[model samples]
Target: MNIFLVPYTRWRHLAMALWCGGFGLMAWWLVLALTVVGGPKWAPEWDGPILLGTIAAFVSGGSILGEDNLRRTPILKRLLRGVIAVVIAVANTLIWYWLLQLVIPKLLPDAWSADAADASLVSLRYRVGDFLAGGLATGIACAFVRKFDHVVSHVAGGISSALAAGAAWYLLGSNFQGLTDLYLSGAALGLVWGFLFGLITWPIPDSLYTGWIRVLSAVRFGRRIPVDAPDGGPKERFVGHFPRGLDLFLPADQGVAEMHVSVAVDGRGRYAARGLSLAPTRVKRFLERVDIRYDPRRPAPLETALSSGDRILLGEGEHQAELEFIMLPKEEM
Candidate 1:
């Protein structure tokens, strides 16, 4: 249970943690405000520490990497990373809050609670308690659930976990009415935020690499461009290019005999290029990062295999596109 075992540099990890807080705060308020306006009077206000905790566990491929690590770990040693993250998220967030209070008191005083001015240890205890309560309840709720698929699925889990936590707090004769809203808003927003964040950072991994044949030299939008250029966007090729559809329309590269080359991105993130064109599609592979080598004159038959940093020439002359095999890494998947 080495809680401090982070693989990355401290500053960068802390930066990302603080970056996560921006989205977390948004998630907390959006749910609370939406529920308060249209729903029951007893709904809970945003649970700040819980929001931070949940964000820390899940964002930016952290949870996915964690899950993979857990699976690779021996069965007896597996622990709930989500739970541990809850503590870390709260601790880090509170530290950030403390700094904000000290550094920007006159300008950002409204951001801090009255408790922020209280004795340091007491403030820490309150925040820690706030995180633990939600963390335990959310972890329990999530354990009984499966991975989220649809947007509604996120909403459901949020409500369920919030209610579960809120009920516990209510029985303690704390704010019972507040728990009602807390349960609903927290559940709904948690799911929604997770879903949105996934899209924002579509982390495509190196292993499950969906590759593309990028144009290194091309004549497009009016000029003969020479040099490998980045694509307009990532093309997740379920089906490689053809004349009809599911492709990038390469009309200029007539040297590419229609259906010039067929590419299949394999399971291990490798791209296998087979020559579909009657004309030999030259698959020039770069050797030792210096020399260029040919792949069997290729590709009037299956010839080239391209990984990261590899290149291909689909056609000759005006229709020529100097192509590269491009892949998004595991972190960006």
Candidate 2:
């Protein structure tokens, strides 16, 4: 199984969000305590609060899990991603502060109060900044984890994060002025935000697992066995007749064994089919229509690389079952 591209479920996503938010509450307390003890006394009035919120965003962005629970992503790489998140969070905090607190007030003199420094924490400008900052940070963080190449995935992450941040800011009354607010609204906001983030950005059963085995000329013609494994971890399917335990259950009378054939995607993203049944599975590639029999006794493994539109014949005579492999386009993911 390829660990990197494993699909992410909704429950896992919500769980991750909770983890981040729980950490966020503690992070707020830690940052506040540090500010009171050693932070610059002459720092701007908004500095401490902004830093606290930014750190919360850092937690949410950095704690996002890309792979499934069974696999362990390298700790060093995850830390590097966290550091990148910190940089993004810090930069966003400064930029938004400058725009909303300094520039916007001067630009809209009548709309903004003269003492903008004393503006309400629930102000519209602050909320807007929160939305933009949260979105940008989340998008970049997801892209970094996905190897910085999946444009659609990152875009989805940005939109979801932005919406989550905006909703939290608006619904929670936009203030973290007290410990009560920090713990209550903070944890609630994290739960809601993380769920939304996962809803849109979580991986699907596409990419390497994007295919299906369709019954061609069998008793159950047109039946489909999806390429995705149970729980979306391994990109392999076990075709058999033993009922519930198999990935693809076929009729036993059709020359299929308890484990007939195993189709899987290798680490290099190539699909291969291995014959397991003593009944000799026959494969015909998409490019070549001639039948090729798997020889398990040979030094080479009894397997063949599969392509879209390939066919696998499972039995002999009128009782034979033919299954066709159909691969979907990855771009659709």
TM-score of each: 0.32, 0.50
Candidate 1: lDDT of 248?
Answer: 48
lDDT tens digits, residue span 70-183, model 1 = 235454333454444444444544555445445543543455544544434232323443433333333333332224334253334433333333333333333544444435
Scanning candidate 2 in windows of ten residues, the lowest lDDT window is 1-10
Question: What value of lDDT does candidate 1 attain over all alpha carbons?
Answer: 0.41
Q: Candidate 2 — which residues are off by over 4 angstroms?
A: 1-16, 19-26, 29-44, 47-53, 64-71, 113-121, 124-126, 144-147, 151-156, 159-163, 173-183, 204-333
For residues 239-321, what per-residue lDDT tens digits would candidate 2 score against the true structure? 87888888777898887778878788754556778787777578886456433344557764477788677888886776677
Candidate number of the best lDDT? 2
Measured by TM-score, the strongest candidate is 2
lDDT agreement of model 2 with the native = 0.58
